[model samples]
Target chain A: MMRALSWQSLVAVLLLLAALFQLPLANVPIAMTAPAVAWTTLILVYGFLLAGIGADTFMRSRLWRGIVLFLCAHLATVFLFTLISDENGLARPGFYVVLAACWLLAWRCVEILSGLQPRSRAGRIILALIIPAIFGAWILIIWEAVTRGLGIPFILLPPPSAVFTKLIFSLSVIAADVNQTIFKAVLAGYLMGCASGFVAAILADRFPFMRRGLLPIGNLVSALPMIGIAPIMVMWFGFDWQSKAAVVVIMTFFPMLVNTVAGLAVTSTMERDLMRTYAAGYWQTLFKLRLPAAGPFVFNALKINSTLALIGAIVAEFFGTPVVGMGFRISTEVGRMNVDMVWAEIAVAAIIGSLFYGGVALVERAVTFWHPSFRNGKA
Target chain B: MSEARGNRIIPVLVMLIAIVAIWYAGTYFMNAPFQRDLDRRAGVTRSSGDLFIATMTQPKPTLPAPHQVATNFFENTFLRKITSNRSLIYHAGVTLSSTLLGFVIGTVLGILIAVGIVHFTSLDRSLMPWIIASQTIPILALAPMIIVVLAAVNLTGLLPKALISTYLSFFPVAVGMVKGLRSPEIINLDLMHTYHASKAQTFWKLRLPASVPFLFASMKVAIAASLVGAIVGELPTGAVAGIGSKLLAGSYYSQTIDMFAALVAGSLVAVLLVTAVDVVGAIVQRRMGARPS
Candidate 1:
């Protein structure tokens, strides 16, 4: 029977069973819910499905099958006991236990699937992407089911669906916030900060005096808490994107400057001699050799700064703002008990920040493709 | 090393001189303009030309006087009653305790999660992404939610604030430790395997030792981040103690000097924490025979 259906089909069947069982059981008396029985049945079926997949590959031993069975049984037992003992009419404890079990099982399944030695490179790629994709999806599914099915308070923990709905409903607001926070504040700050840092790095590299005089102070400034500095910037720049931008510039500048200076100096004496032998001027050597060699390190700083800039802008906005920003919305919404809106804002921020960081990383890969770290695939 | 050391001292001295010079010049040149503005705003009888002349010739106004700030610092930090509202020491104590507590909690949780990921490849693949994704949710956004949620659960206190610190602090530790735990070279792993070393033994001896530098580097970052987290936590709660509360209060009252002083205190604390971490790193490097760069 397992051989007749694909593993995806088996998952679909189990999901159907869970949904079907959820109906009548919804009306069952709290004490007589038999949650454990249902959980055990589901676990056994899921375990069998996993074992069947494993059996078609390297999992040839009964011992391996036994381990899977034992884990599933234990989880089922825990869920059953928790459900049976649940006194709350909410059925949260029971649902949570089952959800946790499902999550664990999903995780284990992904692990096993990825660990399988496929016959081809394409298979390997599929395995790599599939495992994380499946795991992430399962997490969202369980999150949605448990939060919605058991009726957790939206204020406390909104379901993924609600968060998504909020995201859709508030797209315009979120987009405007993204524009204000990321486009206006973060981008401006990042550019000015990075440019200044880069220029300072070059100056520091050129003159020993500047390097000696500035690095320690830069480090000191770097260590200044954003919470401490943000308010000062707001006072100076006046409760707008400018203040947030100023804070980001402070937050991002030192790291970029420090990293670039270090990276510039990383060239070996042999390499320096090679550059000198070419009769290259200082500027020529810097642009042709040192800067190219420093690509990875510079990109590292940029990638790090992407996240740092977002963080600076958000936290800076917390001090004071002009009423339309991701940070302002999030802080205000939370105060107003609109957690779903906060989560939605958070979702937008997360997406933007990740994409920003990832974009820098991708550009780094393309620009620094010849670097040892990238070439060796170590980073 | 000698040149680097000498170079460092020169920068330090130069910075001190530059700061002093700036303070002197700022006090001398900027004071008359400020006082004239004040006088004009106060409706003092002076011709515009006279006001300009007064602005140029007015005695330098008090700009903390360097000595005054020093006196205030000493008064606030030492001679004042420890429980006094004006005492920097009391506020420092409150802020430091929370920072330290949060740092400890955060570091432990980070180490634990990192260890779990290191040992379990599946966790490394699945959980690492989530952990990375977790950072995308800005701490500013998370701070209030955490405070509100924990408050509802009747867990509102030092713990909630520390939790925020932990949230901010843990990411660095986890990322750092993951790098550290994975620092063990393949040859080292092979040597452990040849010695029939258990996973735990291999980890303790090979992976953990190799991870020390990374861990300390991360700790430096974590400590600073934790301090920031604690201060931010103080903001929403309106706690009447700690540097954060002091900053907020000073800002509200427009006590610019007090606000600047509180900022100085926080920055000093962060610098001290980072310097301590650097010292530890030096010691660990010496012990490990890694030798300082």
Candidate 2:
């Protein structure tokens, strides 16, 4: 029966048993430590997690069970944080006990969230978003707790709190980096790359010979270390956003080209014959039938390029840049051991990357609403 | 069949010629400004044809012609001893080691994670979401930090760089494996149930075989990603070895021909790695009683 429990639960239980055996929570002097704060928090955390596990096992109504588990997990987190802060910069059995119990409850909360089979599309989407958010938040919490508790050197990894603080403080600097990298380089390059690739796909499609020939070459180029060209691009375009944009263009082009060609080729002979029967011109058929059918594939490439473009722009900045870009900031700051600023830049990149990908995805869903995946309301 | 194959080959050959022609023209035009300036400085009156020829032969032109890059590639790869640091082959070897090591580590970790996620409902619920969320982050953006931090801990060299590749490769493999392992049809699973097959039997005989094609496809993606990771890994470290450093050196010294050659060498390595995987995948598929398609 215990084997059925998540690893977090098993570990938490063992830690609790060790706590009962009178292990000191930290290396602090016995007279200076209240110690009861740690033990009491551990007990409360364990109790809440146990309740969550029981709710999952015996509960019938999925929604209520989820609520109970979430509540239990959150309450456990609250107590756990209090316990952790009081015992900060110290490692002890009791400290781990609190953390382990909280983690166990989080595991149960996630289990409940994943098992939820919501009927409404809204509920399903909300659940999908919440589960991942909760998961990400848990990782942040653990990173914060462990880094603070162990007093890990900031250079190795700044606590998420410090990173957050730095993020707020350095908003302008981060904004400059984002403006230079995303707005100037990434956006310009991504548009040029995708548009050019789309045009090239049309050109290739005009010649079936070129379509077949270019397809394999496109795939090969897509898989190559295209990012290595950043240096040469910088040399050609000068040390400005244009060079980075050039790198992004090269990085993004092949994926879009390959995907677009494949997408254009998706139409069948029967479909083409039907268009012929309707007396539709080649351009008209392409625009009406084949292009619409290729929506998913086109959007797939767009989504892929969104990430590729950002990465290309940033990495290109590493080779040479105009004193202000994400890659420049990261490379320079790491040299200065300003680790928090580095984290801030990374956080900004992550948030922007997510937004860019998410924006593309939203457009895809709206544009390709007639696609079969959309019809089934599935990802 | 022979005619169809010939049709494909002939078009590719024609396209290759077109690409080279376009590349040479682009180089001439791009280097024209620099070439004309050089000629004016030398007090020489040259025709457009002379200028075009001059652009193609410049020691450090803005854009090297394809032939220049080819010559540089041949010199660096074949002329130099394979053991020498100047050899492109040696640099490629340095990068390839980390790529293969990282790919192996990533594949193992991915398969293990997939197995756990597939067998345990709880892990699937917990881990799968995190895995998807992790992808939203521009992971390679953190590569420099990863290298620097590990360097601080006195853990230098291949391990640190290889970890980056491992991180990059693991996600695709994990996502692919999970899908592959769960791909058994409902009817097939029901048949196994009627036969009283144990979980182990069902997994080995049914899920394992079913996952082979997916595994190969994901591995192709994974190995390609791994090479990219390995190349990028060498960038921030100021390492004197590897293709990335060659790229760095080329840029620093403004050696356009050499830089272009390194890029080509990187591409060659990528092509070789991908083709190896494709060949192995085909063999495995045939051995598994699957038709070639």
Summarize candidate 1's per-residue lDDT along A1-379 as a digit string, tens digits.
1334434334534653554445322223544746566556555544654443444333455346334533543454344334423332344343444444445445556566646677787976676666566656767666666665566677788877679999999889888988899999999999999999999899999988888887877777777785577776787688879999999898889989989988998889999899899999999999999999998889988987888898889987877899899889988998899998988887788888878877888898889889877665665
Candidate 1, residue B34: lDDT: 75
Q: State each candidate's chain A TM-score.
A: 0.76, 0.89
Interface RMSD of each: 2.3, 1.5
For candidate 2, lDDT tens digit of each residue in A337-356? 99999999998898888889
TM-score of 2: 0.94
Give TM-scores for every candidate, taking all chains together and pairing residue i with residue i: 0.83, 0.94
Q: How do the residues B211-277 of candidate 1 rate in per-residue lDDT, one tens digit apiece?
A: 9999999999999988888888887776578888887886676565666677777888898888998
Predicted complex 2: CAPRI docking category:
medium
List the lowest-lDDT window of 10 residues for candidate 1 chain A.
A80-89
* Interface DockQ of candidate 1: 0.53
**Model 1 misplaced regions, further than 4 Å:** A1-101, A116-129, A377-379, B1-5, B19-36, B43-72, B280-293
Mind giving the per-residue lDDT tens digits that candidate 2 earns over B76-172? Answer: 9999999998999999999999999999999999899999999987677667877765666777778889999999899999988899899888988
Per-model lDDT: 0.75, 0.86
The 10 consecutive residues of candidate 1 chain B with the worst lDDT sum are B56-65
- Poorest 10 consecutive residues of model 2 chain B by lDDT? B129-138
